[model samples]
Target: MISKKMADAINKHMNLELHSAHLYLSMSSCANALGLKGAATWFSVQYREEMAHFFKFYTYLIDQGENIELLAGKAVPNQYKTLLEMVEKTLVHEQLITKCINDLSEQAVKEKDHATQIFLQWFVTEQIEEENNDRDLIAKLKMVGDNGYGILMIDAEMGQRVFTPPPGTTVMI
Candidate 1:
């Protein structure tokens, strides 16, 4: 059985994942409004991925026999000055998430919750990939600064991104 502290931590992170989905969905809308169709598609995929992550946590909590608590999340920002700005904010947000996950891992270690620690290792690896992706995108954006054609090319590439659940993720979306 999972400790109440660990369960509560997972619950809180689950809600953050939900908020992430909302944030990405909002970003997708903003991208559409900005005429960045490819970027919009990318953000839409991101939103779906976040939802999947949330469900994974939900299922884990249920399996642990913990009562889930759904809390209201603060509103997400709907407006971004530019695609670069949006992506920058995304990186910042992801960094925050990485920190949270690390904290949870630390807590699990303190509580001697081996299962939770093992579960969080996946997220630790995921955060590395996530941050690397953002950094790569940021570099690309910087390299193409104020270049319409370049931005469009990047958008097209981003459009090609499709959501694939991580291996061993059995939680159905």
Candidate 2:
């Protein structure tokens, strides 16, 4: 049986994952409004991925025989002064998420919950990839620095990204 403390933490993290989905969806809308359709598509895909992450947590909680608590999420920003600002915010948000995942991993270790620790390993690795991607985009955006043609090229490249569900997960994206 999962400890109460661990269960509560998972619940809280699950809600955060849901909040991330909303944040990305809002970002996608902002990109679309700015005429960056490619960036919009990229955010849309990211939104779906966040939803999948939320579901993964949900399923794990259920499998652990814990009751699920769906908490209301706070509103997310829907406007940005520029694409660079949006990407910068994304990186900041991703860094926060990485920290949260690390905290959860530490908690699992403290509780000696081997199963939970193993489960969180995926997220620990995922956070690394997430932060790296954000950093890469931030670097590109900085390099372009208010160049319209450059921004458009980046947007086109972003639009080429497609959502791929993590292997071995049955979560619908």
Candidate 3:
């Protein structure tokens, strides 16, 4: 069983994942309004991935008999001077999330919750991939530069992004 404090932290992280889905959806909407279909598609795909992440923890908490609270926060601004800027911010945000996951793992270890620690190990690895993917995408965007054609090419490339969550893990709740 997870400690109350650990359960609360997990629930809060679940909310962050949900917020990420919302934020990504908002970003996708902005990209669509701006006539960047590729960018919109990219964000939309990521939005779905974020939702998966949210539910992963959501179900976990429910199984643990902890309440998952709906979190409220300030709306994120989708406004950006450039697509590169948007990608840069995404990379930075991903890094922040990786750090959060690491900190949580450390806390779980300190709390002596073996199950929680094992569960968090999955996240620790996932965060590495998440950080690498964002960083690589940002690098690709940088290579594309600021030209209209370059942006279109990047858009075309990003449009191919489709998340396929692996099968076989036992889902909680």
User: Quick one: best lDDT, which candidate?
Assistant: 2
Summarize candidate 3's per-residue lDDT along 12-118 as a digit string, tens digits.
Answer: 88888777777788888877877788888888988887777877787777878888788786588777777677777777877777887888888899989988898
Model 2 alpha-carbon drift over 4 Å, by segment: none
Each prediction's total of clashing residue pairs, residues at least 3 apart in sequence or on different chains, is 0, 0, 0
What is candidate 1's CA lDDT for residue 53? 81
| Ten residues in sequence with the least summed lDDT for candidate 3 | 164-173
Worst 10 residues of 2 by lDDT: 164-173
Mark the regions of model 3 whose C-alpha exceeds 4 Å error after superposition: 166-173
**TM agreement with the true structure for every prediction:** 0.96, 0.98, 0.91
Error of 2 at 154 (Å): 0.4
- Global lDDT of each model? 0.91, 0.92, 0.79
lDDT of 1: 0.91
Question: For each candidate, C-alpha RMSD in Å?
Answer: 1.1, 0.8, 2.4
Candidate 3 TM-score versus the reference: 0.91
Q: Find the candidate with the highest TM-score and give its number.
A: 2
Ranking by lDDT: 2, 1, 3
Encode model 2's per-residue lDDT on 1-173: one tens digit a residue. Answer: 77999999999999999999999999999999999999999999999989989988898899999999999889999989898999899989989888999999999999999989999999999999998998899899999999999999999999998998875456897
